[model samples]
Target: MFKMLNQMLNRTLQRVSLFLLSVILMACAGTQSPNQVTVTGGTIEGSLTPQLAVFKGIPFAAPPVGDLRWRPPQPVTPWQGVKQTTDYGNDCMQLPFPSDAAPLGKTPAEDCLYANVWAPKDADGTTPVLVWIYGGGFVNGGSSPEVYDGSKFAQQGVVFVSFNYRLGRFGFFAHPALTDEAQENGDMLGNYAYMDQIAALKWVHNNISSFGGDPDNVTIMGESAGGGSVLAMMQAEQARGLFDRAIIMSGGGRSLFGDRKVSEATQESLSGEQYGLNYAEKHGITGTDAEALAALRALDAETVVDGLNLAAMFNPAQTNKPTWAGGPMQDGELITQTISDALQQGNLADVDVMVGATSMDIGGNPFKDKDALFASFGEYAEQARKVYDPSGQAPFQVVGYAVGQDRTMQEPARYIAEQMTSHGQQAYYYRFGTVAQSSDNPGAPHASDIPFFFDTVAEKYGDALTQQDQAAASAIHQYIVSFAKTGKPVSDNAAQWQVFAPEQSNMLNMTRNGDMQHGTDPWKARLDVVKAAVESSN
Candidate 1:
């Protein structure tokens, strides 16, 4: 049964820490593993809050600084002593974000292979482990604002984890120069970020049981690019048996179904090299390929604060074409093939699933206006024609956008749910339609349901909603936690849920009042339309 456990013994390397926050380390004395202080970690020195346990940042691999740069990740050294892991580590290096207008905290750096963890507040040796990967289009992001604090989840008896990986051009660059020195793994170079994620999972498999978590029971969950990373992990052979369940929110894996070839449209990186060389000249730095590499490598951390990012900064070298844009490369070993191939081949691990998306998904804001509505939902649109076509009015465009959201999120959810249901696997689905009014306006947009799904609606600063909000949150949270525990999510009922089939057109809807409804879902029609539209080119 524990067939894939041996994949954990990888390579080792070391790097120091460059944390930003004034890590407020604190540990309660009465707690079980109390008083042993100063864990010797590679990153910061201090303890994190919430769990109140001291953390040590073990480098899953050495910093990809030079020759190691743009390569697959190496393993981390098993050091002596408890490594301090209090402060939030540097984010992966990248161009400035528009959020720069009012930045909250520190930026990032190249030496960005790091992971953060939450040890248990109790001594129970059976708490579930939930590892989180943040999403920033695979480029700019790190765990901050306590968006992923393990305290709440920990309160419910689970170990939470979050961490940083390489990003933008620094993380996924693929080059002819790099592929020559290949490892026997038969994998192409780059995707260091993906490697980092896999390495962290390996670390958890080996060490989490030591921290009050069950090594056998782990769930891999994420949002956006991180969600996409979960998709990658799900499709990987080496990643088999690493996670028992998965929760993917707001990400559809960028539709890389069958197209997984390296394109000649690498003009972006070709141009970026020109830009890199020119920028160096403009800054009075001298260099050749190795020299240029050295110049980029030698620049001070502050000087190398790459300005604004344009295009697919993550794997910029390969994303010059629209086909590969915002998509990860389909290298053989690490990512054997496309998710489509995985589904077709039935390669996904047999695991329970909780998958969903929001009603007020991305295009909702633009839908509020007329012109934008027609532009997207007008007479020419397939979804509009399907829904609003009978009315001959543009109001149907809202249907189209919603359908697109459905296409982008819901259909895949249905696909995964139905796929699992077909194989006798436990599956659960939810639609976040509740509009929680905040201090001023309606609440919970594309990602709004996350707070509630995580049972942090109130913790996320949401105040007393009508009794409806509380009920909805309670029910949803119970369903999720139940899924985590038993690989199944159901209302407090003995009726094993009705299995979903393509012909069945049924799903579960969680209303603001916490009522669960089941039947032929309008989303089913939307899913049919969305799939047809997606299969057909725009």
Candidate 2:
């Protein structure tokens, strides 16, 4: 009897121990620990915060280094075990700027082709996806900026994503040898940056579903150069059907690949191949095609970047001239034509679009001399002065500011919207004019709407955010969130945002007072004059 009793006691203890171990394992699984998800390359582990399951530094493509430099992005090799994705990847190589004094997380590098994702902790593969592209005139900018945090969007049920791409000389450099090699491979040349973007989108399409995102409903959005990239992607044949919606904030509507202006004249612009030759010659890299390419490839990455003079490349004084030799190229296969030509020909991606610019984009005046400003208009100088400097008493600085804004951003954005609407596609237009209350800001300058749209005013400005600022940010944020989810921008607190139509030309203007109103095109007359002058040029 004693032996039987001991056996029963041992069995009960064993069962109890097993139950406790199972409970412990279950508790650990439910706790705030690292989470795992499998992507194309392999399984990746990310950490969970209160709001989001964050995954960073996941390789979307192999590092574009060594022989891979200047070549199209290649597929990432699969890895063995779960890859830790707790940190942001290297930023694409760029010169440091004052605006970006504080680094996002990691250092910049040539091997920077990774992407990051932010999804709700409880995501179940049915959330909308938003992929952001940063803007730095195609010469600078990265996806690791702190202001671009995706937690807000993730908290609102969005799977937010961002990635790094090649930039500057590395991104757009075109050499005869490279072109020849591409021809040998029967591949497209130039515009490698756009190729990188497409690769990321392809990755998202294939893998986002694993993160509880709806791959079929992807929205591509960007600011400035990023916005321009969005426009370029809309016209890219390779990017078709990759995204269902697009938001182009502060993107211009001019031709990207060629020098064709939105004006009536059709002029030949510098070809990407020719530009590459010029860049190579300027760098004293003279020799046979193979020798020149070898010399370029042998140079240190920092040396190449430091040698570039972006100030001169993007000199606003050089109007109608190519800004930089290494921007989006007109490689026939990838970027066949400019956005202007594509839209007129009705060859753009048949997707819904939201396009707008800040009230004071390209903030400062481009022209210092009043005579030079009027001279640009040629025959329409008198009319231009009358419209731009209506009072004749206004300062030249103010006059120049208006002219720059009208020509560069406002008109181009409106033109894009008009074209999209005319083609029977849904188009929404907005003008973000809400000025921050913290500083004595000069109107809503370029990129001012970013924080507001992301609903990150507090994160960016800290204690400076006023009650009014918060309200405006919330309204704009919800509008964008609604657009990403439902294909239409709706805000519970703001007025109904009307669809853009050529006849109505209605725009949702976020006023400086934090009120949203349906307003007519305030700059129509000025833009008409600017448009006429541009068309008359050359």
Candidate 3:
């Protein structure tokens, strides 16, 4: 009996020793690796793929909650030890639009000022960086969408970074109480959404070098509202020198405040203070005092979101008196002038630019009839009809759609290229005209070029994605990779993309058959008419 007892004790001790040894080994292994990096917050360990080292959910700013709500991004709270960042952080608080092209992968929450990075596994600080900003009309969008993945970028030998910014009212509100607070504290007022973007760019400038990216060689790119952000950054005083190049994707290069202007003192059609007051009154919280501000911040995130999404933004039933500010405005400090103002005044950063729109983009269905639509073009009505509908038999709806596209996106794209070329900067213009094999649309729809740019067509199309789709994605992705690496965009797989010059008016077209064609723009007459109308209106 004594011998059996002694033998049992020995086996138990051996087992305990093995368990401790395994634990020690794991702890040691986790302590150091190429997958681990120290960012502004703290040391974070990421995951490794065959091609890249990916770090996700590294907080770049403090959670915009409590008193920090609606304030510019604050410094990230430092952490103690290595934090695992293999998963995505919560996306910015917003009601997800069901029909969104790039759906959020993470849950939406207010504590969501996080950035993600992807770098080649063998990186040693020589790779160029591409920072992506998403678009959901500035009301919705997150960086966690699968279609926004940066693995392909890392595979192609460039570092990619993306982050979330506050959206909707939480991002752009401006209450009298807040204005008073800003005055006292010397903090910037309104346009918190843009403030967040500038902060994110600052973070990238400071931390990208640690992840094998050249701090000096960075390209800022975005789509739709994100594209507008790219344009804004090119002129915003605070954003200068943060990036050296930009790519604007269907971001309208025009005045955001049309005929009206945003002012803090006067309650104009687009007054930020008036909008804030309206919002406060709607919630039964009135007054411009500390108590009012506290009550506003005390509201729950969902109550704050209040069903605001892209669908609700465009819903015809929204006849109620306006509460929220439409979106980002000329805040004077961050966004000193409108994108169009800056482009026209030659205030843009001296950098190479690539700007374009899809064949079909936002802006369709405004006029009641063909006559009204053509007449809206003013002095150019005859020219518009000749360029848009020489046949006089084309479907009014189709003609209306074409007019809207030209007015809002197509003409603006060409005009931006023209301005850039005139400013003596290299400008590359493209028209995404590729129609998916499974899609019945007449041309590429708005936001369809996102997956192609990221080379995530498989995620966007799934089983419906074809060989042709893959080829187009490859061609487009190569051009982007080339642009991010060098100042110029080039792709051996596709036809050479020529620089846009006023003399030639060259633009690259990703044809409906998933091929690239570079030459003079075919719709020059239509765009010229739209340009004349815009200039006359201005």
- Top lDDT hit: 3
Q: What is the per-residue lDDT of model 3 for residues 42-76, given as tens digits with 9 covering 90 to 100?
A: 89999998889999998989999999998888999
Between which residue pairs do clashes occur in model 3?
none
User: Cα lDDT of model 1 overall?
Assistant: 0.58
Clash pairs, model 2 backbone: 125-212
lDDT of each: 0.58, 0.82, 0.88
Tens digits of per-residue lDDT for model 2, 165-197: 888877886766887778787866677888999
Model 3, C-alpha of 381: deviation from truth (Å): 1.3
lDDT score, candidate 3? 0.88
What TM-score would candidate 1 get against the native? 0.75
Comparing 1 with 3 on TM-score, the higher-scoring candidate is 3
Candidate with the larger TM-score of 1 and 2: 2
Backbone collision count in every prediction?
Answer: 7, 1, 0
Model 3 scores a TM of 0.93
For residue 219, what is the lDDT in candidate 1?
A: 87
Query: Who wins the TM-score comparison?
Result: 3
Give the Å error, residue 388, model 1. Answer: 4.4
Q: How much is 410 displaced in model 1, in angstroms?
A: 2.2
What is the TM-score of each predicted model, taking all chains together?
0.75, 0.88, 0.93
lDDT: the better of candidates 1 and 3:
3
lDDT (10s digit) by residue, model 1, range 392-462: 56454655566456656777767776666666666666566665544232323665565666665565554
In order of lDDT, best first, we have: 3, 2, 1
